[model samples]
Target: MQIATMTIDEIRVGIREQKFTAQEVVKALFQRIKKVEPEIGGYITLCEEDALQQAIIVDEKIKAGEKLGKLAGVPVAVKDNICTDGIRTTCASKMLEDFIPPYDATVVKKLKAEDAIIIGKTNMDEFAMGSSNENSAFKIVKNPWDTKRVPGGSSGGSAAVVAAGMAPLSLGSDTGGSIRQPAAFCGVVGLKPTYGLVSRFGLIAFASSLDQIGPLTRTVKDCALSLEVLQGNDPMDGTSVKEVKTKSYLDGLEEGVKGYKIGIPKGFLQKGLNEEIAKAIEDSIEKFKELGAIVEEIDLPITDAELSAYYIISSAEASSNLARFDGVRYGYRTEDFQKLDELMEKTRTEAFGGEVKRRIMLGTYALSSGYYDAYYNKAQKLREKIRQQYQEIFKTYDLIITPTTPSLPFLCGEKVNDPMEMYLGDIYTININLAKLPALSMPCGFSKEGLPIGIQLIGGEYTEDKILKAAFALEEELKLSTIIPEGKEEI
Candidate 1:
């Protein structure tokens, strides 16, 4: 059987029925990685021995007639930024090239407890800074849809692995639009849960307030299943909310979108959006309407300021969070320097990529004595205003709809020179982070060039189930069959 082509649910059934052993699935994934990693560059490190060992244990448990967790035996790729005990967690930056955490991140712990096998650590942009994955200190992750185009930033590796059929499910951290943007580029589903909804205990800090850990999968149902395992609060993380009961995400996968109110934010589909992407989103809305959803046009007054505030706030927090990587305690260390100051300067300069350095400088400048109130303080106030705007809109709407990205995946090196233009690609997604709302992006259609386009569904805080239900409804109404990457055979 072609294990790589199967969904997470299908794999679980295969294991339960003894149609395929977990070891065989893990072996197939490794073989797939060996074949595709050269072109995709999805992983920074592959934990072959560890993953296979765990899979064997799962196979034994299944043979012993022991009941398993929801994700038992499912192989998942983890983003490099999330700490994995005993594995190097570099965040795709040279500064932490040799750093290995002594403990797993909270999400990693949860996945392990559920018997999910960690396949490997995936590549990402340095310190989660760039819009495209090209900023990684290691290598860029290419979009599975078109090898010449880029997979979106930070979570690019995680998204590409699932899209390319190298892994069934993966974990990705979304600060700004990392998870959703890459999912859009790779033609997969990515969920960025509400702030504090998932524990962040050992996720290497990017933009602390904006970052939330979620899943990247081929289907919305797989994302929901992964979230179920990773969603509870952690005592180790103060920002994590207390345990909240969540609905069975898989229970309503086939439920149609009857009596649901989907809001279309008019400002989201204005000028600058590509005609093809706009049409795709409009078609998706029509499909939702046909599925018994009530579509309404709404306005978010602070949409314009969202990107600006996101940059200001994120950069400032990143600068502060990154201060600990000075070579004295952890991460990459320089042996050539004599003095402490020289060592610190040399290590950072050589270790960090240009984008990471740029943000650090921008953030340091923003938080400086005279500029704090002008940039950081003002951005915080605007963030509150944006959150308030979302709160008001959610009162009348169940979910907000938008084109996940303004344009299809661009050719490699196309916008690498222009950081501002690259940042603008996330216009539709960054606001959800700013407002602390939950959002999901799913493949909706293809462009004229055969590249994939995505449609986003944004929901109120803690309304992830409602959001996924809407996505599932649209998925059926549109009948969007999964598309494999060109030139690849389904294993």
Candidate 2:
């Protein structure tokens, strides 16, 4: 069996059939990581001894004929921003370079409950602030498909691990398009659940109302399986959904899209959309039609408003959330400081990266006394309008389909200097976050250069089931299943 290419289901069944031992799987995993990590830079930290010990315990349990949890012996990678007890969680920033949390994030705790072995904390943009991994104070994540290209940001490291066959699943937080954009670039499945579906108790905040923790995986089914373990209410997080259901996310995942209604935004294919992406989306729409689903073009008149509102609201919240990093509590503190003011100023000025500083300044200005109503308050009103428009559409359509990105994965430095151009890369994705809706991005087609293109499916709040069913249908119909980058060394 090819351990590197195995899916979550395949690995579980393989272990049950005695095809491989859990220890052997971890050993081979470390061997693969040692060989490729230099080129891939997928993880910011590695936990070889702990992961192996967890595997050994699993093997011993199997020997004793004991019942195992859902994710028994499975290896998983976590994004650095999610807290892990006794392990450093840097958020790819110098401010928290050596900071270690005393407790695990709720998502990490849930993974442990299911018997998943966390390999390590993956890299990310500093403070989850950029659309490309370039903002990372540590290193940029190279795309697995082409080394010169970028793995899309904030969650770039989380997405890169799954694409490089380093891990079968990973967790990433999405504020704007962080999770979906990277997943699209890396040719994997990424899901952003409803805002309150998962707990965020231990997540270091970027934007409180907008940030959501979700999964990145090789297949749509794997995405659903991970969600099953990750989704639940937590008393620790007041925003977590209170009314919980025990229904399996995998129950109707394969039911197919026989009579579903899917909508295509009229503005999604406008100018600036790459020709290849446009063709791929058009092809995907026809495939959905052939599968017996009704597809239509609809207008989301507040589309532009959503983009404008997202920046204002997200920045305003980020300015407030990131203020706790002052020199008093923890993290980095500058040595060149006399009094309190100098210490705070020098600490923030020295530790924060250029992108993070830019956002802080922008957010501070938006929330300033004179401009509060002009910028932040108006943006909140626009947000309500955007949410209502999406509700109006979901009343008629079961899902909204569009290209996951406007362009293919570009060369590493292509848009680093052009901030506006970088933000436009998320045009198709940010609207879903603005409306607090559930969405998924899955592989749809490949460009002539073998770079992947993805299709986004947006559903009503808490309608992940409908979105997953449509994605599973398209995933099977397209037959672009579980793509691993070419030239990956065989393990």
Candidate 3:
């Protein structure tokens, strides 16, 4: 039946009708993984036994006539950064490659409660540092659409799994476009809910203030379905907001886009963006207009400073969050160290990838005594300014639209040498984290070379519903279902 090709909605319907058991679905997924994973490198750890056990339990519950959650019996891929109890939580770094948590992360707990079978832990850029999956201590995750190109990162593995139909849904963490950028490159839907909207207790720290966990899925409705299970507050996480009662995210899928005002930031489309990307975004904006959305040009001057502030603030927080991985508590340990300092240095140097080390050094330098105020402190102030700018823009517009990335997916190893250039590629996305807003990335068009182009829909804080509705409308209008890479026969 090609169960992997089914969307979450189709799977849910199929499960209700007893067309297939959860165990069968999971077994099919593992078979697909065994067939494709070696070439794509999407997963780091595959829990075949545990996954089958959970699937069996879900199947039993259905047979017993027990109520099931929206995600019941569905298989979803999890980004390695999000902790799953008893599963090795390696944020694609050698440091925690063998560290297993004693408890589930907030999201994992919620998914389990919903009877979702977690299939495996996917690969990622080490500690969510780089935009390409090449930085992963594990193998690089290639784009399912074009193996020669990257899938984007550090959520590349999650995005690849969905694009390749290995999983209909997956979880990804975005500190600075970790979710959206990859979704864009892989031609899938990736959403980053507002800061504090989803609990972060189980998500390994990257940039504390900017990091968020959200879904990467085949469709906007699938993303919404996953969000229904993952959203809400956990007392364990101080940043989590109180649970909010809302209608089903899928209820509004057919709602037309009348009376909606979508703001297009002129600054985003201008300067530094590739010609094809700019045209693609404009074409998408026109599609929204055709769908009855009132498109207007808006200005967001603070976007120019987004990348700078993101790097400074994110690096500072990373330096702090990563300090615990010094070979003492968890993760890799050095056997030949004569002193504590030697042990710490050797372990860190050996365990961390180059990009992780670069960010740590940048973070340490930003937080150092004399430079703190100039770099870290100033960056904070700039963050507030960006937030204020977004707030003001949202007051007049229901959502702001822009290109998810300035260009299509670059070939693997294309931008690896120049760190700064690679960072610049995330220009349109990093600011949303700084502004603490909700945003989604969805496929808008395909480049001439066949690479996917994504358009981002940014909304005010806690405006996930609005963003999803807009994305859903666009998805219907575009009718852009992604195609699996042609080289999978060789995999």
lDDT of candidate 1 over 1-491, digit per residue (tens): 66556788888878888889899989988888888889999999999999999999999899889878778889989999999999889999988888899999989989998888999999998988877899999899999888999998779999999988899999999999999999998899999999998999999898999999999988877887888888877899898888677557777767777988888877776788999999898889988888899999887642556788899999999999988888888788888999999989988888888999889998999999999999999999999888998899899889998988888999999999998888888788888898899999999999988888988999999999899888887776666536677777654
- What would you estimate as the lDDT of candidate 1? 0.88
**1 or 3, greater by lDDT:** 3
Which residue pairs come into collision in candidate 3?
none
| RMSD of every prediction | 1.2, 1.1, 1.6
Question: What lDDT tens digits, residue by residue, belong to model 3 across residues 1-491?
Answer: 57556788888778878999988888888888888887789999989999999988988988999999878888888999999989998998889989998888999999888888899999999999989899999799999888899999989999999888788889999999999999999999999999988999989999889999999998888888888888887898898887666446777767867889988886776677889888888888888889899998887753546789999999999999999899988789988999999999999999998999999999999999999999999999999888888899888899999899988899999999999999998898999999889999999888888888999999998888888888888888888854555654232
Task: State, as a TM-score between 0 and 1, how close model 2 is to the true structure.
Answer: 0.98
Better of 1 and 2 by lDDT: 2
Off by over 4 Å in 2: none
lDDT of 1 at 195: 95
Backbone clashes in model 1, listed as residue pairs: none
Clashes of each: 0, 0, 0
- Ranked by TM-score, the better of candidates 2 and 3 is 2
TM-score for every candidate vs. truth?
0.98, 0.98, 0.97
Which candidate would rank higher by TM-score, 1 or 3? 1
